[model samples]
Structure formats: C-alpha cells, structure tokens
Target: MMMAVGVAERTGLLETAVKATIARAPARLLPYVVAFVACQGHVMSDIAILVIPPLAALAFKAAGRNPVAGLVGAFACVCAGYSAGFTVGALDALYAGITEKVAAALPMGQEAPTHLLVNYFFTASASVVLALIGGFLTARVLEPRLPEPTGDGSSGDEESPTTEISKEQRRGLLLSAAAVGVYTAVVLVVWLLPGSPLRGEGGALIPSPVLSGIVPLLFGAFVIAGVVYGVAARTVTHKNDVPKMMGESITSMSGYIVLILVIAQFIAVFNWSNVGTLLAVKCAALLESAGLTGFLALVLFVLVVTLLNMLISSGSALWSLMAPVFVPTFMLIGMSPALTLAAFRIADSATQMITPLNPYLFLSLALMRRYEPGAQLGTLMSRLAIYVVPFLVAWLAVLGIFYAFDLPLGPGAGIEMP
Candidate 1:
C-alpha cells in the first residue's frame, strides 16, 4: 500500500485526479464535489491532509467562492472520514489485525473472522452518507459564514497561480485507470468462475481465499496502477526507479513501524499476563449487573472513545489499548468484535477536526494560512468544530439503522456474536 501510494504520489497521478475532478465540476456544486473527493483521500493517506485543502481552496477561488470555506471543508472531510471509505486500505488491515489478535485471546465458542473487509459494508455506506453531509455543511453552512478571498497576499505578496492538469498527466491517469480495470477483471474471473480455487468448503465466498488474501490483491492492483501511471507520465524511465520508490516509501514509514512494534509488545504482554481476560470477564459482569449490556453500553463506549481521541490522536494506539479490554468484554456480552470495532471507528473519526492533538490539524492550519494569511489555529478549529455534530449525528444514524436491521457489518460479520 505504501509503495503504491508513493508511486502514485511520485507520478502525480493522485494530484492530477483531484485537479481533474475539480476542473469539471459546476460552480454551484463545487463544495459537494470537493467534500466527496476529500472523503476518498484516504487513498493518499497523510499526504491528503496536505494536498486536498490547498487544492480545494484554489478551486473555490477559481469559482468565485470563499476559498477558506473550501479549505476548511476539505480538511474536515479528510479528518472525519478517516476511518470511513469505499475502498479497503491500510487502516482496515491494521484495525482488523489488532481486533483478530485480541479476539483470539477470548475462548469464544466460535471463531471471529477479522479480515481486511471486516467492516466493509458499514464503512462503504457511511462514506457516501458522510460525503453528502460534508457537502451540505460546506455549501450551506460553512461557505456562507466565511469572507471571500481578496488575493491581497498578506502572506505571499502575490496571488497563488491557478492549478492545471498537463496533457501527459491526463494520459497517465487514463492508462492507470485502464490498468486497474484490467487487473480487477482478471481477479474477478479467477475468483468467480466455477470450481474456483478462491472459494472455501462448499464453495463459500466468505472465509475464502479471495477474502482472506485481500492484502496481496490490493498491493498488486495499486502497484500496477501506480507503475503504469509512472511510466506513462515519464516519472519512471528505468525499472530501478520502481524499487527506489518502494524503498523511499518504506523509509517514510519507519516511525510508524516503530510505533507498531511498541504497540505489539504491549498487546503481547497484556494477553500473556491473563489480566485482559480477567478484566473483560469482570467488566462484562459489571455491565450486565448494571443492565447496560446492549446498545446503551456501546453508546457509552463510543462516548469514552470520543473523549479519549481528543487527547490521543492516534487511532491505532488508542484501539490497541482499548480493544484488549472492550472487545472481549463486548464479546462476553454477546456483541461481535466487528460491532465493537464499528463503534470505535465512529467515535474515532467523528471528532477528528476538533482536536488540537492531531498533527494534521497543524498542517491544515498552515495550509489555511497560505490563503487567509492571518488565520490562526483557533479560527480553523472553530470552523472545523461546526462540522463535528453533523458528522457525529449522521454517523450515529447510520449505526442505528444498521444495528436495528441486524445488518451484516461485513461478510460473515454481524452486529452480534452468533
């Protein structure tokens, strides 16, 4: 995933795509379009936090709208939609792996499946809904409150130049898209054909090779698309360039890799001590005694996570600590790990923009100042705080609808333990 994103970033495929989308949008629908694209920025990871806001500001400026509104809206969407996306990516894998590990600590009668798409159905649906909410807020609520950009260049002494997609970039995007299509088609054929090896016993698609093997599949697709884009865009003239890009990507993740190691050790010790299981049983009993063993308990859990997120901006770090206790405790109370995970995701993301602890918040504020010049962090926070309630409300609504209908969170993963 890192390698693919690196290649895409290197070839400017991702930037070109964002620019192209904004270029074709109608003036009135610009916010809506920007909001939706921002939600999809998970593909670019942290770079999205840096890339989307400025581009959005520029696009809004071109459309004679408030550029600050565009900047804030994109930043809000990227943060709030962190754990929600139509596509399975690194976040899904990280959360799923941790959930699976902690879930295994408990001696449940049945195994809990925590594959890459464990929350796929819920998140994909939430992505669309959040996009709409983001767009509505940006267009009707945020833009109207902000002043128009004067291009006074209080910060730069000159107006920012307009962004454009070059002919080569257009060609690269087209070829990369075609590459993704061809790769997907081939995979579908291999997985869907009769007597396919990807299927499980009795030909079940769930618990099958295709689902379990998603990481490699995603890696292949991304690499193919990115490399194709790189070649077509003239970013890669030699095969060695691909490996160099991969090396650079891995190097960039050194800090994250170290963090993961520390987290892994903590989890291992927590489980080995047998204290996690004991705490979970005791906690579950306490919740049951309080008659809070169902939806109410999950609600409280979400609230707690939301508060903690303000202090600890790293979702992985927070989840690593919480999952050991909450996941098994929820499982004891008849909730599936996936259901508990879904709740954490909601709380984890819904309040993202309001938190000062987030590194991205500072980055976004810096970007905002590029246009607003005198804009302060507090100003950015206030604009972003306006987005929290609507995002939180809409997210809770979706969760309620899914839980009430007893819908599958993902393939073979329901709202309750079997």
Candidate 2:
C-alpha cells in the first residue's frame, strides 16, 4: 500500500484528485470540502498530513480566506479524524489483529473479530459526521479567530504559484482510475460467482477467502493503479522503478517495524504471565458492582482513553499496551472486542490536536510558521483547543446513537458479545 501510494503521489495522481476537488468547490463550501478531503486522507496514511495542509492553505487563499486558518483546520481534521474513513486502512487491520490476539487469550465463547471491517459501519459514518463538524468549525469559529496571512502568503519559502493540474497528471489520474475500476470488477466477478472458491462453508461471504484476503486485494489494487499512473505520467521509465519504489517504502517503515517487535514481546509476556486475565477479572467485577457494565462503562472507557491519549501520542503503542487488559475486561462484561476497539479509536483520534506528545502537531506548527512567522506553540494549542470540546461531544453523541439502536459494528460484528 505504501509503495503504491508513494508511486501515485510521485506521479501526481493524488495531488490532482485533491486539487480538482478544491478547484470546483464554491467559496462558501470550501471549508467543508477541505475538511472532507482531510478526513479522506487516512487512506494515504501520513502522506496526507504533509500533502493536505499546504494545498488547503492555497485553496483558502484562492477563496479569499485566511490561508493560515485553512492550513490549521485541514491539519486538525487529518489528525482528529484519523480513525474515521469510508475505506478500511492499514490501521484497521493492525488494531483488528491485536484485538483478535487479546480476545483469543481470554477464552471468549464467541469468535473474536479479526476482520479489517469490524468497525467499518461506525467509523465510516463518523467520518462524514466529523467532516461536517470540521467544516462548520473551520468556517464559523477557526477562520474568524486566526490572523490573516501576512507578507503575500509566501511564508519565506518557495511557494507554488498555482495549483492547476497539469495535462500529464490529469491523464495519469484517468488511467489510474480506469485501472482500479477494472481490477475491482474482476475481483467482484470472481468472488460473487456461483460456487466461488472465495466463499466459506455453505457459501458464506462474511468469513470467505475474499474477505480474509482483503489485504492482498488492496495491495494489488493500489499497485496496479499506481503503476499505471506512474507509467502514464512518465515517472516510471523502467520496469525496475516499481521494485525500487517498494524497497523505499519498506525502508521508511524501519522504525515502525522495530516498535512492532517490541510490542509483540510485550503482548507475549502479558499473555504468558496471566496478569491480563487477573486484571480483567477484577476490573470487570468492579464495573459490574458499580452498575457500569454497558453504555456507561463504554463512556468511562472513552474518557479514560481520551486522557491517556494526551499523554501518550502513539496510537499503536497505546493500543498495544491497553488492548491486552481492556479487551478481556470488556469481554467479561459481555461486550465485543470490536466495541472496545471502537471506543479506543474515538478517544485516540479526537484529542490529537491538544496532545503535545503528538509529533505531527509540531509538523503542523512548522507548516503554520510558513504563513505566520510569529505563530507560537501556545497560540496554536489554544486555537486547536476550540476543536476538542465540540469534536468530543459530537463524537460521543454518535456513539450513543449507535449504542441505543444496537447497530451492527460491521459484518457479523455487533455491539455486544454473542
């Protein structure tokens, strides 16, 4: 996925898509459009953080608004709405694997959900709602409070004169889209045919080979689209370019690879010592005694995670440490591991702007400094604080609605244990 996304980015396919959306948006709707685009950035992973802000600033400047506000608002949406997206991402797969492992250790009667789409229904809906909230805040609250961009909006750095999509880029995007569309059609045909090999026993689609093999499917789709785009855009002049790009992508993930190794050891020890089960049993008993076993228990968990997220900015590290304990504790109370994971995502994402530990917050500040040289860290945090209350409140309300109706979190995954 990284290799493909990198190739698409290098070929300008991603930037063209973003620019096309912004270029067509009306002045009054720019905030919402930018916000939606930022939320969609999760599909491209961290690249969106670096790509969206400056482009958004340019869009705001074109629309006669404060470019700095545009940059800040887009950055906030990308970070705070990180977990919410229409399409499942690598993070979803990562957390699902962890949830499956922790739940498996607990002897939960029902099967634990390891599917990437386990939280799809909730997070996908949240993506749209959060985008709307981001848009409103950017237009009504954020822009008015932020100072106007000074000194010709250049930020003392080399700025692109325009965001116009080049002819080569447009052609590459067209070819990429076509390639992905064809690839998807072929996959669907193969999977949906009568007596398809992708199906499980009795032709069950949920636990089928197609669903379980989604990672490879996604990888193939992205690689196909990216390579097509790169070739058309003249970015991949030789066949070896694709392999080179893949190697570079893997190289960039060295730090995360090391972190995962440590996390694996920690989880192994956590399971072997039986401390996780003991802590879970005691915590479950306490929650049950306090009459906080359901909605209220989940609410408290969200709050705790929100607070912890401010202190520990790495989502993967935090989830790795917490999942062993919380997954089982919630399961003991008859809640599904998926639900526990969903609550964690809400708290983890919503407080990102206020977390000083978030390395990306510093990246955002540097980007803002390009437009506002006098912008202080305190000022940025204060302005960002405006987003915390509304985002948290609105997101919790979303969870409440989902809980009240007992909606399925994803395919064959519910709000409670079977």
Candidate 3:
C-alpha cells in the first residue's frame, strides 16, 4: 500500500483508501461509522491517522515542497491523542474515559489521559488546518530562505493535471456517490427521526450508518462504476485496465500493513513492561515536589510534557499518568479542568513535529528524502526551528489567552469561580 499510494494520484487515492476502511466494518455498527471513524480515536490517538504521512507527502510532492513537518505532525497527532482531526480509529474510547474520570494514569491518576481530554473533532480539524498552513509556508517561504534539507520520496513522480474526466469516470463517480448517499441517508434518518427502520436495530446509539460493508460497498461501487464508465467512455474497455487500477491500491498498502503490525507488537510490549506507568509516576513526583502549582505550574508542566514526549511517544499514556494529580491539584488552585487538559494537549502535540522517539519520525524522514534527496535527520531538525518557532509562539499565545480569561472549553468545563 505504501508504494502504490506514493505513486497514485492524490485526489482519487485517498478516496479509495477511505472507502476501503469503511468497507471493512460490520453492518451492526454502520450508523455513526463515518463520523465515528472520522472521529473515532476521537480522544486518544489511533493508527488510522497513519494516512497523514503518505497523503501529506503527496500534497507537498505536488506543490514542490518540504514534507517533514506534515508527516511528523500527522504521525505525532495520531500517536499522542485522537483529536488531531485529519484521522481517527481507537483513541476515542480511551480519551473519553480519561476525561470522564474513569481510569487512572498508567501509574497514579484514576484515568488514562489523567490530563483534561480534548474534544476530538475540534482538535483534529485544527491539526489538519494548521498542518496545511505550515506546509504551505515552508514551501513558499522557508524552503527558499534556508539551505535545502535531505529527503527520501520520489520527486520524479510529478502529477500533471488530467485534461478531463471521461464519461466512464463520471459514471463511476455517480455510482460511488449513490452508494455512499444511501448509506448516509439510512444513518441520518435513524439519528434524527429515531423511528426510522434502521434505528436501534443493533448496538448503535445513533443511526447515520456510514460504514461497515459500506466502505467495501464504496470500493465495489467506485471500481465497478469506474469500469462501466471506462468502457463507455473508451478509457477502460478491457478487463486488464480495470485490474491494473485496482491492483495499485492493494500492492502499495502491503508494506504499510507490515510496518503497522510490527509497530503494534512493539507498542504492546512497551505497554506490558509497565514502563509508561513507572515513567509517569516518576515524572509526576518530580513536578509535584518541585512545588509547581496553578498557572505558573502549568507552564512548567507543558515544558516537561513537551520534553518527555520526545523520549516516549504515547500521548494517552503520558497524560493518563499525569492528569490525575495535576487536574485535581490545579482545580484546587482555581484552574478549570478543561483548561488543565488543554495545556497538556498543547505540550503533547507540539513536540511530535520534531521529536526522535516517535517511530513515524523515520517515515517522515523518508518523505523528506523524496524532496530534498540529500536531507538528513540533522538537517530536518535545523530547519524545523523556522516552522516550530512560529507555531510554538502561535500555539502558546492562544493557550495563554485561554488561561488568562478563564475560558470555558465546553459544557462542564472551564476555569474557576468565587
């Protein structure tokens, strides 16, 4: 899948993958599937966010730009927590539970993220939008101002625009749309009307069935439709052309799957070792004893969180360990639960853009190779200061604003009162 995605056209390739993810789900959970998956790991991070590195690579590759920050940011967003927005899958349950005050930190807190959990859709979208802007800035400004870094992706694969969508392609699109629309209609009816045929039929709380065999439904729909359209439009009359297009997606993803499974095992082993628990415990003590408290304490906490995130990659586990003590402690000092959580998130999210312990950091390095060719780890780090400096300033300034005003993060959230 990795290589195929690397070579495939950006626009259609993601559509194919998105459909594949949905097509693989079961029918019972179809309602809330799209929004679920789209917002799935809504809290903690998930592997589905993995798509960022490749897709971000494609976008920058197309624009003739640097992909380091894009890929790193994408990976960091997923590994840390689920709110990074551009992707989703498992972090939702984990994050939701943490903020709900359920589980304890891996070591001390009663919850996983121990810190305040962020609203997924809100944060995730921010990551995507910010990443695009960052990438754009780097391509248009930073790349030219400084010495170019080394890279690992193929610059030779320039995507020239197609002259037009052939009739057959149009037909395929219509089919794809119809199939998705039917699935969507079912979900919305159930959610809004509540008396719809599909409502509460299974375990689903909401009806908007958007996935499950639905994605495969889209895969089948788009491919068949594309083929039908191809034949009529003279773009693909032969069986051979159809297979060739479909084959591209499968073959390219194979490497990615292999890498994912291996990483899964490594993470599993790390979790089992209780290292995260021990580390969070140790860090919590140091911070507490240092006598950090209230808003001033939060500044120190963020600095530490950002520093630790560089060494350990799991954002949920890190917060899980820290939030319990800090949240209640900060609350006692007049800070809001929501604001406390938001601080940890900013710190956690910031370091991923440049940290080394993150595994995907390597993948992004490879992406950089595609553009700079001679780009190295050292080089990427040196150049990142440009984007990071601005982002840090922008990111923290906003956080400072929230703290000063004692803002409300949402319902049942915010700073203190008299």
Candidate 4:
C-alpha cells in the first residue's frame, strides 16, 4: 500500500492523470468525476480522502459549481466506498491474512481456508452501487443544499491553471497501460494454463498462488506501472529516483505505521487474554438460544459493527479484534466466514462518513474550512450524516437481500457453511 501510493505520488501519475481525465470531461459529467474520486478510496482510504477531496473541490470550482458540494461529496463517497474496490489491494490481503490466522483457532474440523478473494464479488458490486448512490446524493441532495459561493469558486487562488493533459502525459499513461497489460497477460498465462506452477495441487484455483499472492502482485504491478509512466513522462531522469520516491512514500506513511504498531500490540494482548473467544462463544450461544440465527443474527451483527465503527476508525485494527470472536461464532450459527466479512465491510464503510474518530474527518474539515472560512466540524458532520444515514439504510437493505437470496459472496463462497 505504501509503495503503490509512493510510486504514484513520486511519479505524479495519479494527480496528473486524474486532472487530465477531469479536464476532458464535460460539465455534465462532473458528478461522475466526484464518484470516480470517491472510488479511488478503495485503493487506500485515508490517502484517498486526503488526495481526492482537494482535487474534487478544484473540479467543482472549475465547472463553476459549488465547491462545498464537491468536497463533501467526494469525502462522503470515499468514506462510504472504502470497503469496495474494483481490484484487489492491500486491504483485501490484510483481511484475509487475519481471517486465516483467527480461523486456525476454530475447533479442528471446522476451520475453512481463507482466500483473498473471499469478498471480491460482493465488494465489486458494492463499489458500483455506492458510486451511483454517491453521484445521486451529490447532484440531488448535497449540491442543492449548499449555499452558492460568494466569490469565484476558486479556493483563495484566482489564478489556478486550466486543467489540461499534455502530450507527454498521454504517452506516459499509454505506456503505463501497456506495462500493466503485459504483466497481467503473464499472470493469466501462469495461472490459467494447464499444468502451470501457479495453480494449486490438482490444478485448482482456490488456495492457489494467485489467491495467496495477490498483495505482492499488486505491489509489483503498481511499481512497474509507475516506473514505466515516470520514465515516459520524464518524471524519472536517473536510476536513483525510484528508491528516492519509495523512501519518501515510506516517510509519508510514518503516522500510519505507528498506528498499526499500537493496534498490533492491542490485538496481541486481546488474543492472549482469551476474552474475545469467551465473548464470542457466549454471544453465539445466547443468539442461538434466543432463536436469533440466520438473517436476524446477521442484521444484529451488522448493527453492532456499525455502532462500533463510530468509536473505532481503523478497519484493520477493528477487524483484527472482532474477527477472532465473530468469524467462528457466525460459522457456528450457520453463516460462512465470507458472509460475516461482507457484513462487516458494509457496516464499517457505511459509518465512516459520520465517524468523528476517523483521521480523515479532521483532514476533511480542515479542507472544508479553507473553502468556507466558517465551516464547523459539527455542521459538516450533520450535513454528511444526510448521505450516511440513507446509505446505511440502503446498504443494510442490500445486505439483507443478499442474505435472503443466499447468494454467493465470491467464487465458491456461499452465504452459509455446510
């Protein structure tokens, strides 16, 4: 995750490409641009919130629209869409890793193999759903409620350059695409070809190299694409530039690293205490005794997670703590680990926009204040709650429907365990 963001920042590939894409878009397509920026949150949620909001604000300003609507809409989408992404990335790998470790503690014959793509299908669907919801809310709700800008839509800068894509950037983007295409082709051949080494024993896809090794593949692909783009665009002049950019990227993520370490220690202590397991067993037994199994149990679980998200902002940390208890319990109650994870993701994402504890909330507020000097955190929260509330209801409804249908959460992953 750090490496990917570092490469993009160092090469200026993301910013340049995004600006270029926005520049070519018609005014009517500005809402789509906001949704697109929100979807990028799937890459790295915190980073996306920081990077995309300002750009979205600029895009709204350039279109002579309400900058507040653009900024808040982008922020809301990033928060709500954090759990859904088009491609598998670090978050998917991290969740799978935690699930694997925790599942090992389940009673011997009950444990299931934890694949990285366990929630891929559901999340992919969620990405599209949330994007459309975000676009609608931005245009219909947020924009209408926002007061018109008193000044020219610029954020204190009257002389911002026009959004344009240069020939060099175009060539660079094409070269990057070509690099990704070649790499993807190689991966497909290795995994899909008969008797290929990437496939598991008996040529199975599950528990195969492709499923287990997605994170490293993502890192390599992003680095390769960034390097190719950088060279073609003249962003990288010498051999030393690559490492320099990587180092800078790591430096920028120091705060996140510290947070991870603290959370890691907390998880370790929680596990050693055995309290999470005890709680899970008791809760599962209670729910079962109370006839709260199946869809009702799942709904209750989602609501619990949603409330927890208000106080705890870190998804990985919260999952590390909760999965130990919830995964096994849910399995015992007839739900699959993948379904449990899907529910967690929906709940976590739905509440992020309204959570005051989220680090991005502070950053977003700061950004908002720059545009509207009188912007207060409370006021912003209330406004964003409009989007968050409906998203929560709609998302829970989606989850309930998914549960009622007994749909597959991913390839070979059903809602219930046999």
TM-score of each: 0.96, 0.95, 0.52, 0.90
Q: Quote model 2's TM-score.
A: 0.95
402, model 1: CA deviation in Å?
1.2
Report the C-alpha lDDT of model 4 over 1-418, residue by residue, as the tens digit.
5677578667967767667666666777787767765765666535667667777777888787887887898888888878886766667767876776666565631446467788877777777777778888888988888876554434454454345667887899889989999999999888899998889879997668886677677788889888998999999989999999989877877876786687567656656887766777888999989999878787788889899999988898789778888987887777788888888887888888888788778878877776777778897898798888777766667777677888777766778875
lDDT ranking of the models:
1, 2, 4, 3
Off by over 4 Å in 2: 155-162
lDDT, candidate 1, 32-57, per-residue tens: 88888888787787888877888888
Give residue 398's error in model 2 in angstroms. Answer: 2.0
Per-model lDDT: 0.85, 0.83, 0.48, 0.77
Query: 1-418 in candidate 2: lDDT tens per residue?
Result: 5665565656566777888887778989999999888887877778788888888988888888888878888988888888887765567777887788788877672476657788888888888888899999989998987776654656455655356877787788889899999999999898888799987779887778876777788888878878888888888889888888888877887887898899888888888999988999999999999999989998899999999998988888899988989999999999888889889988988898878888878878877877788888997898888888888877788878888899988777888887
RMSD of each: 1.9, 1.8, 11.0, 2.7
Model 1: which ten-residue window has the lowest total lDDT?
Answer: 152-161
